[model samples]
Target: MFSTSNTLLYADKLTDFNMPMPHIYACHLSDQLIQFTGPDKKSYLHGQITQDVNLLTNDALLWAGQCDAKGKLWSILRLFNFQDDYFAITSKDEIENALAEFKKYAVFAKVDIEQNKNHQLVGLFGDDLSAVLSELEIILPTENNSTIDFKFGKAIKLDNNRLILCIDKKAQLPSCITLLESEQKWQSLSILAGEPKLNNQAIAEYVPQMVNLQAIGGISFKKGCYKGQETVARMKFLGKNKRAMYILEANTNKPFEATEVEQQLGENWRRAGKLIQTSFDIDTNRAYALAIMPNDLALDTLLRTKQENPISIEIKPLPYSLIEE
Candidate 1:
């Protein structure tokens, strides 16, 4: 039942997805959605993730995190209700290990988890979605975290300029919607949005709060006894967590590679943070990235890469407040 969409031809041999106009673009999210069904789905998941499972409804999506025993995240994903069942959408790099660990913890639960290959997610972005909405003939989601039904499957509005589609793999996309073959734009926008997404190499490296997950409404303090709840609650109450996710940008002459962020401490640079994701915008000719660093670091702090050809980078403010309260 799960398969790739043959209807979507690769425009890979063509130009890039970044159009001259800023927002008018669409690309495959390239993310995977895991389906959950059964009578006990709610009760079972309520005790497993950082978000309260009882909050899930047809009208909205909730950002959630599944963590390890020590409170480090296994993955951070978007959870939603499509029709009769629930779906958890995550990046492709996270699918294998996250799925394995997820199933391991569900052995006694009545809920069933599956990789729903019948569906695929499309990233829709533009200042004006009215024209695109008419082409698809779907209801538009009005607010953040809102969900709306479409011909293919379901849609979730991430913000005013962005929404995502989870459609049937066999369905044909409307000609009005220009679907991009590459997901690089999706990667850059997500970095600018400051939504923390982790790859396999970066998993289990930090607690959820260290990545500003709680700041973005991805964590619930009132949720009862989920896995690693103790560690999570302690971080908030004791003010023990000192790290946060930050958006960084730099004008570069060419593509740059960096694994860690370094601060200008006195004259010598020292390791300050880990770079989680990076993307280059063809239009702006600049590189953008997401890095986890000290929560109290001054904004626009001078930083660079540990690489030999170090690039100068500065922190940019996230769209959402990093404040916990």
Candidate 2:
């Protein structure tokens, strides 16, 4: 079990981002929308995604990944049933193209795939979420419960304290709240939580274990086969996976592209892993980064960037335990 260190609090500057603040984080799945309906909807998705769709009782949230034929993950999706339709939310950049890929194979299947760009999905995350919901008098559904009754799209409890409120962009939310103006604080929270955003730069670069997916209940090994099942299972059972995701906090303002190799040690660049998400808090003079690296490197090891101007980076232990031995 990983606990927040006092060093983290001392090293990073505290922000005025208080509880009940309405912070907006973009859900990239809007770009890669797959609307699965008709008689074969459940069976169709079960075969495509990494998780078992039958496990979701129409009211629960299903976290799954879409992998290429080679078993590399192209998209991570959060699937949920909204009445008669099944929505597969994936990365914005890959979703549009992923939908087309699915459509081509789904010629005989009755399922229909389309991108829902007009409807924007935002994640309202905070630790004191219960208090926020109590103030709004809208009790967000639990992870197992679907939000179809609330009519605010759907809500899922991502963690012990974090609550995800999914709402349609065009639809008006009854809750009285204003958007908080701090992107830095939100990014910090995500890093501390070890949650990586689904983006083009990081997509298809690592398997589920590389991003701590199995530790977070994203992968269901016991469930039967799905896309890339052979590779995922083989790696897990045979101890072939060597890399895992880690949250690194650094003291730098320079921008780094995700998945780009930052050369260190010598001329040869170690393509061990890729950067997931990062943000700089100008007030704190610090930046936060989520990167996936080889397990042998050892997590929480402090190091310096190999850029023209090197920066100090301290890797923090992720909240979840790695699946690799």
Model 1: weakest 10-residue lDDT segment is: 6-15
Per-model RMSD to reference: 3.6, 7.0
Task: Assess every candidate by TM-score.
Answer: 0.91, 0.79
lDDT of 1 at 295: 87
Question: Candidate 2 — which residues are off by over 4 angstroms?
Answer: 1-33, 130-137, 141-148, 174-176, 181-187, 254-272
**Model 2 clashing residue pairs (backbone):** 29-90, 32-95
Candidate number of the best lDDT: 1
Tens-digit lDDT track of model 2 for 49-120: 678777776557767777776567777777777667788766556675567666767777877777765445
lDDT of 2 at 38: 76
